[model samples]
Target chain A: MRSASIAECGHEESNAVKETQLLDIHDLVVHFLREEQVVKAVDGVDLRVKPGESVGLVGESGSGKTVLSRSIARLMANAVIDKMSGQVVFQNTDLLSLSERELERRRRKSFLSMVFQDPLGYLNPTKRVGRQVAEALPPELSRRSRRHRVAELFTQVGLPGDKASLRLYPHEFSGGMRQRVLIAMALASRPRLLIADEPTTALDVTVQVQVLNTLERLHREQDMALLVITHDLALVAELCDRVYVMYAGQIVESGDVETVLSSPHHPYTQGLIASMPGQRRRMNKVDGLVGSVPNLALLPSGCRFRSRCPHAFDRCEEMPPLMPTSTGSTSRCWLSEPEAEGEDPS
Target chain B: MSTRPDQSATAEGVSIAGAPPPLAAKEVSVVYRTRGDFGRRTARHALNRTSIEVNYGELVALVGESGSGKSTLSKVLLDLASPSAGEVAYHGKALNTLTRTEMRAYRNEVQVVFQDPAASLNPRQRIWKCLASVLELRGVRSQLELNEEITKLLTGVGLNPAESFARRFPHELSGGQQQRVAIARALAMKPRIVIADEPLSALDVSVQAQVLDLMIDHQKRTNAGYLLVTHDLNVVRAVADRVVVMYLGSVVEMGDAEQIFERPQHPYTRALLSSRLSIDASKRRIRDRPILTGDVPSTTAIPSGCAYHPRCPIAVERCSIDAPEPRVTGDGSSVACHLAE
Candidate 1:
């Protein structure tokens, strides 16, 4: 559905990408109707991805990272999307402003593509791997060229791309190989931006490392912008240049990975880092964050995270904006009032 | 059926190690019966001569990737399934040799908390009934006594405002809350040993940490030996006293957690450690030593010699023809790889 009119847009569409930024999302608000209750999945999210930039969207479950990313391409399938009001500008054009047919063309011809957590679900078990990957190619390509292009894409993503290898079914491939197939399929269109949502979470540790390496290679060689949405801060720390920490549907903090990871400004960010299990020399006895994520339907007013914040005070009766911190980071907490520079909190 | 309890029923008095391990597997091997194409039954060796012990007061982690037979070993110990070729014992009594009454007591003394809490908990039952039923099976008759015990069990796992949670059904609770209920039910047995299989994997990071801490607290208070079965090395580092690394249905390395983690000797163990995502960003490296290639072999057709030979980075000619025997090194570490020597 998102590819039909891309071919019809003709010659002028070839030079349409005049924007400096690869993708820009402004004040995005996405709400879902669940059992008659409004679920503010994403509220007033602002983010940008420049060409060749690698950014990490760090959040736990229910932080709306997935919804926020999906909304960029209007890719929410079979969901009760009640209210979606936002501008997803891609390459000098507002994608939201395009007509239904134009939006479909814009999405298919525009700057973004997505890779999901589950590889098995996306790939058809009964179909040949080569045919499955070729489905993502443009309709203008010859049948033989599509098959040949798929094999090339498979090799690009580090899959065994021999003729015989491409003929095997999805079931014959290992979990890591299945993910590689998905990556190859995702790369077929060669979009400027690739949104990978927990692409390595289900894989084994060894397999995860392999996939991360593949993603890094693509980011550097392909010159493609990457918006990696995941809960694994370690991967973000390793791969991404910039990081955004989200909590309860809003981005609470955003900064360079080192600055954000090393000295997190928001309490939620600190708690998330503390929650992750590292290689302990001795058995660690530290206390983790006290409670679970609040229900999206019954989310507290004022500050969404106030109920869980340890430093939450009376001032938290009102929402906090994404204000600048002294360490060149952005934080959404009243307590993070840009303490004096050169003062090491660690 | 009336029976006199053993003098060892006073589990609280057994302070620490040196006694016989509460749960022990002696050269246990398990073969599963599966039907292949053409209705031909095939026997697959899930566990082969795997010997493990869960000592009192120490948390031992059984770490392995998928298809490494870690789950098979856990099931064998739990007696949820029988081993095709070895013996599983509970407090020195072989599982097959135990009398019906003794076996029932053994079942209560060794409880297991599974990966999925929702599945472990009965969906039709209320939280209160779940705990109450466990207590009732242990011979708690009075309604008042049952309620008090249930509240304590729930509170022990930090499911507070116990009254509210007690009345709520399983579906009403979140994943974390449901897991807490599962842990509460498991704790109701007052087990001498707890086998938690990937308990924290399903949860979010914040919830995972809290649940891990709760399990640690329970282990300390009860001094029960814990067998934490998981693929996450970080979880093992956080709580486990000892570590056992498995690959392709065999123990590749077993030692003190510090020794295994700080200086892993076996190639398989080293690869596992290097593959882990460390929190320290400065040393965040992708291409490290011992980065193994290839996935684990199929259970039905395991590699002839050392199952790891195909993927081992430093495999020698000997590795392909002869499997290494378990060798005990100084400092109490055990490894079953020729290269480690």
Candidate 2:
């Protein structure tokens, strides 16, 4: 079955080889203005997603992965942004250059849609769940058709699409059901690219598996590109084809999911893999990185992870560029540099 | 429930061999009664006859999903909520039988670390003041001694250059730092038993590992019994000496962590283990594991017989009519399933 899926993926990729990337991001920088300090949430970063490909963006809380994703959807609040630069190209169009009205129109046109972590916060508590999903549909549809489309979308997301269930309020649903409702709303736009940010973090393990299965099925059946942003390595391994590891507002590593997870080159990536509780047996101490994430406003001059990195040296005083490794993966660490005068640590 | 002598002996060897455990809940149940429409009375069985014991120097993990009665069980064990049936005991002494002075000592010996540090810690108080209040209750009154103890606590939790951290309020510190302070506060009393409820769920994975290491290191140093209540199975597999699996107000399985992970007997245990997403690429494809069909049934209207029958993949007609009593297997693990041998 796995080999068959791989063959299918290869066939799909070849068919879309001549097409432009589904989404392309270049040197994107976003800084949040906090009183006297500028929090460099997302420093210079580049990422891309091919058509119908699933990409995973992995990071910790303050690693700027969220900021990077929000910037792509033009979801960041303009009031707090001190500086924003770089181009977010979606479907050969510079989304960054588009006005608010145009972006709204584009969003309504099913170009792209995003699902956030908190399901309850996005849904209207007072409005019927069915009507909320219907609102995401195009305004041209008749009321009867909109209701039918909402039910179909609900069924697609594995939720009860019956009239009785549709009339229920947001509070009446479980956490997993509520998340499925949000996913139904995202799918209502019939978007080509779906961006789900920590979609299953708030759910239980069993419920998470159910939701993941739904997502995988939808992605395969609809031929939609998916960008999953989460802190879970296991989630990435299970759902994404390729992954980009973000740390301190930079892409520390990017490669095929199997390759990066199995044999990571960046020290930060290695640390993350090592810290997973599943890697060790009962009572064995996990070798977690020493310090907390750096303060964004007062980030270290050189490598931001140097403070917590065990192998930090004088060379680390200068930031290392994201360089290609022997395994066809990119890593931003001096240790992975081709000409470095030392044995490869990974 | 007939007990075979050899099996009972093995069970006694694994647990309850010598002195009494630090904390134990014996057949505890909690039922919340509320008035419904038309002045009708309704009783929700939040916890149903659950028994758990945490021995000194051991880590016991209570694993379950939301509304599975894990939190209700924790509340009962902490003596914060009185059990509708059964009892909570400390060192074999029932909580209700203890004198006022003994109860005060019991309160001092049991410390709790909550899930969210921001909500748990006093926002208005500085870090030192939080630890100081706990110390003051322990009868350390002098200014110089309090400061020294505060510094020591901060250093113990890896907040080095402790003096600087001691002056900051809870809001000033990061999530990890605030959690460290909370851990420091919990450890200040030098309690024999610590109850941490979803302690690492709020933080990132890296910070989670750090906080878990701190907890494990402290448990080793102090030989304190730890009852860790959480939903993450991976964390439980890493540190728990014993595991208790709860579903819809009842414990379906309880056994040694290794045995439970490697050879889970109960169907619910098997499903939960299979559902866990591992960081192995070879297992990437969604294989045909026994994925449960639906959500956990409501506690207010629990299933007639086996609470899990509705979602159990291999459930039989008997499962819907008769609730299986917990039976000990040859491996000394207890499973509440008729099919478990």
Give lDDT tens digits, candidate 2, residues A6-106: 45556577534323467889899999988879999999999998778899999999999999999999999999999999989888788999999988878
Against the reference, the lDDT scores of all candidates come to 0.84, 0.88
Model 1 chain A: lowest-lDDT 10 consecutive positions: A1-10
Could you estimate the TM-score for every candidate? 0.93, 0.93
| Chain A alone, TM-score per model | 0.90, 0.92
Clashing pairs in 1: none
Estimate, for each residue in B7-47, the C-alpha lDDT of model 2 and write its tens digit.
22222223456645657888889999987647788888899
Instruction: Say which docking band candidate 2 falls in.
Output: medium
- The TM-score of chain B in candidate 1 is 0.93
Candidate 1 CAPRI classification by DockQ: medium
Q: Which parts of model 2 are misplaced by more than 4 Å? A: A1-18, A341-346, B1-18, B35-42, B287-289
User: For model 1, how does the per-residue alpha-carbon lDDT over B1-341 read when each residue is reduced to its tens digit?
Assistant: 13313436445323255344567887888888898757898877789899898977999999989999998899899998798887887765678877888788778888999999988889899998989989998899799999999888888888888988999999999888888998988889888799998998888889998888888888998899999999988888878899999987889899999899888989989989888887577886554423467777778878877888898888899999998988998777999988886
Q: List per-model TM-scores for chain B.
A: 0.93, 0.93
In angstroms, give how far residue A162 of model 1 lies from its true place: 0.8
